[model samples]
Target chain A: MAEVRLTTPISEEEIRKLKAGDTLYLSGKMFLARDEAHLRAIEMFDEGKELPFDFKGLAVFHCGPIVKQDDTGQWHVVAAGPTTSSRMEIFQDEFIERFRVSVVIGKGGMFERTTAAMKKYGCVYAAFTGGAAVLAADGIKKVEGVEWLDLGTPEALWIFEADNFGPLTIAIDSHGNNLFKDIADIAEKNRPKAYEIIGASKE
Target chain B: MEFAPIIEKVAFNLMKYSATVLPDNAIKAIKTAYEKEKSTTGKAQLGAIIKNFESGAEKSTPMCQDTGIHIYYVEIGADCPIDDLGKFREALTNASRKTTTEVPMRPNAVDPFGSNSGDNTGRYIPWINWEIVSGDKIKITAFPKGGGSENMSTVKMLKPGVGLTGVMKEVVDWMISAGGQPCPPTVVGVAIGGGADIAIKIAKKQLMRPIGEPHPQKEVAEMEQKLLKAINTTGIGPMGLGGNITSLAVHMDYAMRHPASLPMAIAVQCWAARQSAAEISADGKVKYLHHDIKD
Candidate 1:
């Protein structure tokens, strides 16, 4: 797997070259927007309202993070874990197409719609480590701000400036390669042999 | 013997501790998983999970944003003085409030009718399963069930002739198909031979066993090892990045089944398998099992 470092205002072309299993260390601004924020953005697009922020080249993280205040009362993310990425399958394609997002970061594999959209839209889907919220937060230099308080803290949009924010792997690339599907195919081929080994072990 | 009050207190504390501790297990498993994972992608995901758990624990945070449905397995003694289980239920509701705020668990309980409880407790504060035993002590185990892994659990009612081979295929297929959806590396809990509902219950209960522990019965132990190997061989790996180890353990609990049916249930625990227990006596003696909470 190749490792690439990303800075602010990444080009869509750069995202297209990423392949499944390629590691990326992202330093720059990334936006946090879970289901509610996504829906809201879609609503805004439909209503012709001014968007919350510029959407081009933005990386949207699928997360609803837990927040806590420190001894100094500075709010910090306690566990900013990625929610299952597939849950956003219905909206990902449309969201990417409309927003021109350079990257989509979350856990698990995305759907065919997302992968196809990424290929067409010059974007990539990155799989962040599922449970490593603390390590993910360590990459955050500061939280720039937040939006959608009514959506609750978890659903709110958290904007952060990050430094080497990932060891994120590109699960779905612009070339139509999907790491999740590839792995599944390999596993399925070995299923019968796996069963045989299990049988013998049981005996 | 006025068992309602005591039951209430026990259930209440159980719910509170369950929310906080269950994620601890998730964190531990994920960290271990990251270290052992061979897949580059899987290791990356495990690293993220490790960060998530560390942040949750250090910040007194909830491990997953989804705090999950609260499930309790209650083992009540026959000689216990508590006559009414209802009071314990009420106590559980009260405890749920403290847990939501203290553990800062996500408020996941929503009314089926579109009303949000805001607090974790609503129609069912804590889902309860009761086991009446011939004893004087009451023991309760709490599993804070997250939606990701819970969504992956499966149950199948097989004819007796289908036997162990059929069971193995189903379990492995279901999990390998799950890929990274359930957040690997997962702990697989298999409940075999019980009736439909009991089988599912046993599967969930089996997850309470510590990682790497084997079944007491020799045949069952062999089955557990076999399933463990088979699942790992799927190469679903840690976080589905593709690796050598997909599962940390395979735990099974069994009960006698009907002559014609062999029911099997698979309960998958995400890397973050959060669970805790509390045992209370009629004289007010309390023992904390599994998770150790300071203060």
Candidate 2:
């Protein structure tokens, strides 16, 4: 119900104060990583290798963007939207604990393990509207850097300097509330009536 | 072979147009849903989607980052001068590569050996579904299928006795399981009574039809309406965040079943529903059907 504006390097207290259903407009540095990047980062963590970038206190986007390079060799985000966040469910809990990331932004929400970690680690999950790629790109001020291009463009780790980069809704709050789970519960309860109308029952 | 150049250009435009501009039917449905949506979260999701569409059009960028795998439904006339299907396939593949860099579409085609071709074309890519008819022309529809929604698509075999009711049940279950994953308000395409592969193909093909248009047959049309209603009632809403409009439409097509089999397939098209079409005449002239190409 409240509109909150946050800058990068946000603190646990700021994330903890937000609740499910609140909207956020984020500014400052954010990193984009999806399936391949996540796997690679986790491997680096286990290998005791020096990570290329610091994720602590910043947001990590589950995005694979379409970027182009100019003559000056600077990367530009053309269309950057969230991939499904739930796909990172396996690595997220560990990722949060290790990286100290305060906000996780993506679409379609994450699962129980990630939610529990968010609550335990004082982090929140915000959703950028799914498929709203252009709007998402509009908020990005610059591509600060990129790593893991070897993984391919979409799967690479992109460091973005975001400016008012969201109208993100808090789907999973640090206090254990989850909007997606609530909606799923409602859909499950409503299913039987639809079944009756269609004259079909659970088999 | 005479019309190869025209086919290639038209195919390229189809891919580019579909990436940046949504079809008219899709635009209309989204606007209507926005006006009527009751849930706050649903309204917010739709509002962002609408804004994204405008931004995409203004900037000439792909509407979604996925850009998707390029799939084509091609119909070639029997009397068309391009008698060699290989030439037609080659033309489409070349078009895919052109559009990938020009439209700057994501290089979505990945090799099974763990490498990206770095262009949208690869083995059997720009996957063409071919049909032949009477005219001396070729028409092609480009469908950019996003990964999230494509993952939500399913095919199942049911008992013959389960009938229409069973189909509805499965569709509902699928929608529930899909939740916001496919980026609803999705368009659900269902095909019944074919082999597993055929049913899946027809279900996906049905998605290319204009939204809200009913099937020509009364029985099939009624089934579509019923399925639509049931899906909306699920309260999955936009992005499955809960609302009155979970789906924009439900389209159904069917074929005769084997005596022992009732295979069904459900194809989920995201609300973006990006597709475009073009026709190439025997004389080498190309006409864009669903969208206009700027010179």
Candidate of highest TM-score: 2
Error of 1 at A1 (Å): 4.1
Q: How big is the positional error of residue B249 in model 1, measured in Å on the Cα after superposition?
A: 1.4
What TM-score does candidate 2 reach?
A: 0.98
Q: Tens digit of lDDT per residue, candidate 2, span B1-295?
A: 6777777888888999999999888999999999989998899899989999978977889999999998998998898887456787899899999988888999899888878888988888989988999999889999989998999999999998988888888998888889999999899999998799999998998888899899999999998998888888889899877899989999999999899999999999998899999888888778888897864
Clashing residue pairs in candidate 2 are none
Per-prediction fnat values?
Answer: 0.58, 0.76
Per-residue error (Å), model 2, residue B291: 0.5
Q: Write the per-residue lDDT of candidate 1 for residues A42-86, one digit (tens) a residue.
A: 889988998878978978888876666567756666556677888
A-chain TM-score of every model: 0.90, 0.98
lDDT of 2: 0.90
Worst lDDT run of 10 residues, candidate 1 chain B, spans B18-27
